[model samples]
Target: MSRFTSICLGFILMMVSCDERDSNPTFSHDIAKIIYHNCSPCHRPNQIGHFNLLTYTDVKTNANKILYTVKNRLMPPWPADPHYTSFVGEKVLTEKEVGLIETWVKQSCPVGDSSQIPALPTFPIGSMLGTPDLHIPVKPIRLQGNYTDRFLVIKVPFEVPRDSFVSMVEFVPGNTKVVHHVNGDLVRFEFDKKKDVYDGSLVDNLVWDSTIRLVYKKIGLLHDDGSYPTLARSVVNYLPGVIAQKYPEGIGGWKVNRKSAFVLADIHYGPTVDDVWDSSYINIFYAKSIPKRPLQEFQLGTLGVSSIVPPLIIAPDKISTYHSSCTITNDISILTINPHMHLLGKSFWAYALTPEHDTIRLIKIPHWDFNWQNFYTFKKMLKIPAGSTIYIEGVFDNTRDNPYNPNNPPKEVHDNNGSMRTTDEMFQFIITYLPYEEGDENISLE
Candidate 1:
């Protein structure tokens, strides 16, 4: 071979190898992909996360924070015990994914060839499912810029022209920073006679220190009485990092009675906010046709506690723990479970015990955060037999050491004389399931 040709070939090989390295672990190719997929959903603006991780600049600026959260198993907060059942939409990074971020940060975030950067995934604007068929909302709530947590309960009337099959429901917040969480319920009732009150009579009856806990009951349950035809079932609910509620494919949507009046569940937005106005609303999606199996949702704690009564009262400067359960009368396919506690929650666990004494691990959150709670859905439906019992237990801390106590000097927390509040505490599991059929277990709830 001629000397010139040999030199050219050698140069070409080195360039090819270097190109491979560029795509190997560079920020544009590797770290960006991981962040966009796992962290971007919550980390982006207009979402719950504090900072944005959309672009290389945003990510590089916050690379150290990201590295710490991922290494400590904090960001992309999913608390379910993976050993039990693999879940859908779980953003928890795998060991490899976590290490990739750590390496990118340790090496100083390098922006490789920007051309290889992938396009951002387009998330739906109005509704995650699609444009909602009906929008039922109360007047937008305005904040006075006090930076105090506020709860508003209003019953807005909606006329359903005919029977509707709801495929999905979503709570889209107007201002996420001011709107911490929202609980939406659907019931067959008329609200024309009810008058909407600001800081209603319920909030008036509470004793607390300068920042002591207030017993704010019925934050959304307008009539304290479970007055609707049936228990107020939640069709739309929101936590900091949770998304829309859509049932599994082929599994039917919950049916709303024909010509019925609906109530909008109240919202929780108090401390850690601005004067921004929030007009959160509920978006209901319709199914193309009725589903084969209808979805059913029920609470398994406080209201539905069957096995043993859990504690609702929290003493001053004390840590409390309790357990609650519900017996499965018939075979059922479990789709999703939501563990709910107010600011004082410490940890949570949920599992099932079959009649044969076999245990089916459902979901467990070792550390509970009121700001980051979400619905945990199984990758595939889990079927529990007719003779099984689902149980949930949670630990509560009202001591001053607990950072989220919400009060300066932790006061005695009780059921507002009889009701519950965000400042007060309660233990329960919200289970979304459908009656099990012969082959229901094979269906996916994703």
Candidate 2:
């Protein structure tokens, strides 16, 4: 081999290496652009999300955290099933984009050209787009000096000249930062016009004098030991961002009789503030008439997993999977699948197994957020064959490390008796489906 030949080969190899290094996109430009477009809205200043990613510094500092959240599909929280209809403002990233961010972070988050930086996205003042049909507000309530969870019901009087239907409803938080969640229900009659309805039966004066009791008197207890004694906490309508669900098209148009009354109760958790006053409210959007289809929910769980009864402690920080099967007796079109769990819930997934034993993935929440738990409505109706077996699985974490742990020193929780006591955990898979028939249409459960 001659010296000239050796030099030429060496030069060629150096050029190739330089090209590869230069083509490696930096996190500052390519990666940061994705985060700013998708995350900065709520995650920015004074928003509900915990952190901000408004600038290059913010993205650079939390590069690894960003990578983790995006990889897990937890940071840009869109909970609906991807197989369903697509939604506006979805935070889902393409496979290539996710790969780019992951690879960029591994390369030490290199800084690309500053001039190539994209413009930052502008977020709305609130989650809603325009003025709502009806805005219901709750008087500012003072919080205890310590972390406390309180449920309040604010009655909103609606005078329906005739029967009407609701298409879309949004809970506009008077104080978004402090207001944790909101649920609204439409009742036929006015049980109590004014009995301090907003205070979740906490005030003795209101409960004793008011004709309306917090507990649901109609729905009989499903359990034997009385674990779920009263329907005091049952929310007909609820909105929790990232989990705030929209009813199937036919579902939202339920009839509200003339002069009928509806109640909006909000659930709030104040962790940091001890003596802060917070106000929360909701706005409902109604249509003049009902839709063509009707919506119904199928509850699979709340059944005892064991014969041994009362105070079923599943324990925190531990993984416990519960199994339940439902057979579709009649042909039905499913609009949404909502998996419910309390503070100790870590993840919930549901799928359908054909009579032949083939598996169909329904919905999967690998990392669950109790604060953002919601009804995941499919964009399109999911048709299940009659006699199909629907399977559900839920995992719980009761450890002290979980931020949502309600217990001071976490203990074992279980599903015992009929009631869901403080020391117990409840598992349920609530699905919204429409009866299959001709002229059957979609409904919305907003």
Candidate 3:
């Protein structure tokens, strides 16, 4: 074809595509599937989402709000940039999907066919994986109506039939609206060392004046002779939009004694206007066999193996950048990673540099959301050779322009010696990995 003819033909095709895309989009036919896949996971009942988006009516009422959030790239809350690296179970929506939601809302959200709408997905109740072998209930805690954040340490003790293997432990928040996050540890007590595992206080408020050793004493985490029991760190954790981490069989499991207790080192709960009671519990899944490999963890920045450069002290009305680095002494295969920060966090990025000067991207969050921090799992195992150094860079905004800043007039904010309070600041990168094995990079972690 001639040049003019080809140009005219291309213009015509482009116009046709635009018309087809902008045509009358309906909720039942065009939008329901997207909402169900991306929004329903947390927007349904008993989840972190403030409202439900299950049925057609439920979505129609919030159509404008949904359109705004998707258009702004705010709602489905995947902080990691997909352009840098990809992860499993990412909830990011495509450009075309966002456009469809916008077009549907602009067209007044018509229900194309009531009978053609797809049925809502069945979300497993209480447990996301399956039925648990045992359920250990945490003692109920009461919160006053005062609008202030509270942090507490609790112990949930249980005795099983005999010594067994635990494949996983899942935390279920009783009050999803107020519960922020939990960092739990497993305490194993010898059957003969302690006669009763459930004899002491189940919960205690965390105060600035109290030391960790004092809190442990108050909660009875010691044995009869006053020696500490075996403790496993980061065994159970929970965040607003995070699913519990699980691996393939024989990958990561723990051997539990007949008498054991789960120690929630720090359980954070957000502010509430009315008094409430929270009765969260832990679900234990028994393993069929002993684990062949156990996960190892290390951290960088606040209270980690590495310290933050220039310290994590931000001044008033300023944006600052800080970094932390750690050198790997042994070859390892990585499974999951979690980047942590408090309210002032603006963005985060982490990567590894090899001795040969090659770079491997780990994760990069262009925009950080304090509410939706997840323990990101890779699709397959990642291998980091020895002599490689991992680096992390985090940016914090402590100005009035930052809506999440806690202070009215941003003051000098410091890490406050690795405090866990929401008002204070912290920066940490926790990595879970195992010693390297042959063909580890080829194993799927999904």
The candidate that wins on TM-score is 3
Q: Per-prediction TM-score, please?
A: 0.82, 0.71, 0.91
lDDT of 2 by residue, 1-446 (tens): 79999999999999997666545867555776787777876677655677788877888789899889888777677664454444333568877678787877888777688777777766555435355566655445666667655554455444545556666555556545566765555554333332222323221111121223333221211122323212212234544344344454445455554433345433554364546666655555665457666566667777523222222357555656666767777877776666767778777778887777777668877777766656565555666777888877777787887787777687777654334232356677777777776534342223
Per-residue error for 159 in candidate 3, Å, reads 1.8
lDDT of 1 by residue, 1-446 (tens): 99999999999999998666643567877888888888887777787677888998999999888899888888778766566567877767888778777777778887889988888887656666667888866557677787666665444445566766777877777777778776655654333422332323322312342111122233332333434233246666777666775776557566665433334434677565456777767777887888777768788665564533545777788888878887878999888888877788899888899999999998778788887677787877889999898888888899998998988899877544324356766577888888887786777767
Top-down TM-score ranking? 3, 1, 2
Candidate 2's TM-score reads 0.71
lDDT of candidates 1 onward, in order: 0.70, 0.59, 0.88
List runs of model 3 lying over 4 Å from the truth.
Answer: 1-22, 207-211
Task: Give lDDT for model 1.
Answer: 0.70
Q: In model 3, how many backbone clashes occur?
A: 0
Error of 2 at 404 (Å): 5.4
**On residues 333-384, what C-alpha lDDT tens digit does candidate 3 reach at each position?**
9898999998999999999999998998999999999877888888899999
